[model samples]
Target: MARCFDGNKLVIASHNKGKVREIGELLAPFGVETVSAGDLGLPEPIEDGLTFIANAEIKALAAAKAANLPALADDSGLEVDALDGDPGIYSARWAGPKKDFTVGMEKIHALIKDQDNMAANFTCALTLAWPDGHMESFEGKVFGTLTWPLRGDKGFGYDPMFIPNGHAVTFAEMEPADKHAMSHRADAFKQLIAACFGDNQ
Candidate 1:
């Protein structure tokens, strides 16, 4: 059986406000008291991992050890098929140090080939680490196509331009609750919940 989360306190090992907020909401129903790494002033560790889960694990472990609490970390990004996943793990870096995704979005648009095959996907890797070093990881994805003239202002990241399959509007066009229902992060969270938090849910 997967290790179950039996603690009431959890540290969200991320500085991104969007991720921290979203994760906190997901954990709310379980009655977990959440604190962000940013709130604790935890330094951002080097994400030297080669893949999403590796990075997630790195962050989770770092925060878990530092906070002496269970830590949950997420590493996610958009992958463009035609571009051969150009910015998969480097998604955040593409935004530059200022975290300006608009610049990253424009760069993606400029590099797209065969606009008709603008196939892409948002990928997420979620990892939970304990201070003792044990860990659990889960991953999820949402397939979609790239859209231009980025729409809506509701979501952060590349949400303004990516439309999920069978959806008319970009992720940013949907309400927060709506996006949470089907986002890549939510997908990963579902698995994490089912495996480690099923009893609580």
Candidate 2:
């Protein structure tokens, strides 16, 4: 059986402003107080894991230990089929020190220039960990294709360059509620809710 989150306050183990905000909103419905790692003066641990799940667990465990509280972490990235998932785990690193997704997107576009297959997808791995080192993890993905000249300015990271499978607009073009409705993170959250929060569980 999966572990459960019985705590009233949870730490969101991430320093990314966009990610922190999105996750805070997601946790609001549960009525749990959410604090961020950045807000708590917690250092971001190195994300050297080979997979999203591993990385999420690393961050979650680090925060849980540091704060002595239950914590949640998400590791998400964009993967292009043509690139053979070239920046998969290194998605954040591709943005460089300044975390500029514009430069990262340009690099991807340049590498796949003249290529027809622009298939891509977003993957998210979420881990919830307790102070005792016990944990539960979940993953989610939203399939989409690459778009050039990127559209919209709402979302952060590679959002503007990705056109989700069923939508004409990129994620950056959609409203926050719209994006959250079908986001990779949301998909993962569903599994998490079922595992950790559901009455049936």
Stretches of candidate 1 off by over 4 Å are none
**Segments of candidate 2 deviating more than 4 angstroms:** 199-201
Number of the predicted model whose lDDT against the real structure is largest: 1
155 Cα displacement, candidate 1 (Å) = 0.5
Looking at model 1, the pairs that clash are none
**Model 2, residue 112: C-alpha shift (Å):** 1.1
Worst 10 residues of 1 by lDDT: 110-119
Instruction: For candidate 2, give the lDDT of residue 63.
Output: 100
lDDT of 2: 0.93
How many clashing pairs does model 2 include?
0
